[model samples]
Target: KRYSSEKSHIQGTSKLALGIFDGMKKIHGMGARERLLLQIAVLLHDCGKYISMEKVAECSYNIIMSTEIIGLSNWEREVIADVVLYNTRDFDTFEIMKQRDGMDKRTYLLVAKLVAILRLANAMDRSHYQKIQGLRVVLRDTELQVILDSARDLTLEMGLLRRQSEFFKEIYGIYPVLKRKRNA
Candidate 1:
């Protein structure tokens, strides 16, 4: 189930997004449609890699921005593209904000929240091994805890999540704690 090689990445990513989105909604002031867009962005996050690994992030952004999604408006597509642009690396969030064309605080937060969740969700399946079987997310006052159910060691996934968690923390104002457990 390598993300770079197959369709399973979409399913895995959607699963990761659902858990993260569920936790995020309780902590952020976002609408249901914005949350659903986050889920769609997760599934479409890496479509660029399938086209060319050389510049996957850039390609994915372009593909998403250009594609006419069945249920999404142009603005919705832009939001998804913006979220995908930062999926693989760190970017200046300020620059991202300026591109929103005078979005209100809540809409800005919605976009940021989508990007943050997408980052963590993608990292949850890092190494492209798809070892994670389930995820439980708990948002506390000071930190966000993600409990992962897996059959094997999750060292890679944890490390990636930690790296990506910085953005999550920046957006949501909570440190991220990722752990693996054998039993539910």
Candidate 2:
């Protein structure tokens, strides 16, 4: 049952990532390589949850640092781990920027961008039960809109939408407005 739940959660996250990626591409014209990195960031954003809840982010970093996931070099793993760790709301961007000062500017920017998207995607699936049926991303001149389709009660959905919007605004420098898809 746990495995099944995890699988469903992963699938939901993937869907959210796809929507966010598509919106990002349209909004910022991201290239293939950037898109790939963003996808990887999204996939592994919550891997830390496998460890204890208190230190899930730290555990995720440790896992990535210690294990060799295929197609990701050690340096790449480090970047991903850093992005994951920094995605937590408790950490401020200034702090993360300070830690990243020694690294290449391009790498820091890339990790920051991916982390922002991953954070939003993770928040969109807060239920961990695939309750969100689908998502639509709309790109406006000054803001991004995420329309969530769900059949369940609104409390969890609203909470996730609000959290995701916060990350979206912080990362993209654009306002994020979330609205439910009302049945006609």
Candidate 3:
């Protein structure tokens, strides 16, 4: 609340991310704890925009890492920070490996997964108009489909999602395809 003024976008992104997270839970071995972390990350991912639009990702990462959220350890905070930092920025494998000092391979993978989900959610709300009325996740053997129900045009969202989908595929080994349908 203190850092974010646009509540709807944050809330909508969180909802979309949770929906995606739940849908991918079984496939990725993420459980309740990861869900909580993802929710926290999504909720605060855009807070950096409060300080600087040009450096939202970095500002957001610093804010998240500096603040103390009870029940979340330092490592967990780092996970959330990384999720926020890379939510919009281009990802670098070597840079991430060097920055994460004590993060094990499994935890690093978890961060990547969460970042992938958050990136998709952010792109869905890129315009801050919340055009997505409903989100449905369907997993196939080779592709993960995100069916969006909305009456509004989504050309911008679809284009951003196409750009973000590559990271999702890199992390999950399954391509994410966005499908839009008219609302009933």
C-alpha lDDT of residue 62 in model 1: 87
Order of all candidates by lDDT, from best down to worst? 3, 1, 2
Question: Which parts of model 1 are misplaced by more than 4 Å?
Answer: 1-5, 95-107, 182-184
Output the lDDT of residue 176, model 1: 82
Report the Cα RMSD per candidate: 3.0, 3.0, 1.6
Q: Pick the candidate with the highest lDDT.
A: 3
Please give the range of 10 consecutive residues that has the lowest summed lDDT in model 1. 1-10
Collision pairs in model 3: none
How many clashes in each candidate? Answer: 0, 0, 0
Candidate 1 residue 156 Cα shift, in angstroms, is 0.7
Q: Native-vs-model 1 lDDT?
A: 0.78
Residue 110 displacement in candidate 1 (angstroms): 2.2
Cα lDDT tens digits, model 2, 73-173, are: 77677777777777674544555566754566666667767777777777777768777788788888777878878777757656766766666676678
TM-score of 1: 0.87
Local accuracy of candidate 3 as per-residue lDDT tens digits, 1-184: 8986589998889889999998887688888999999999988988898899999999999999899999999989998998888888887675566575555777778888899999999999899898988888999998999989888888999999999988999889999998886443
Assess candidate 3 and give its lDDT.
0.88
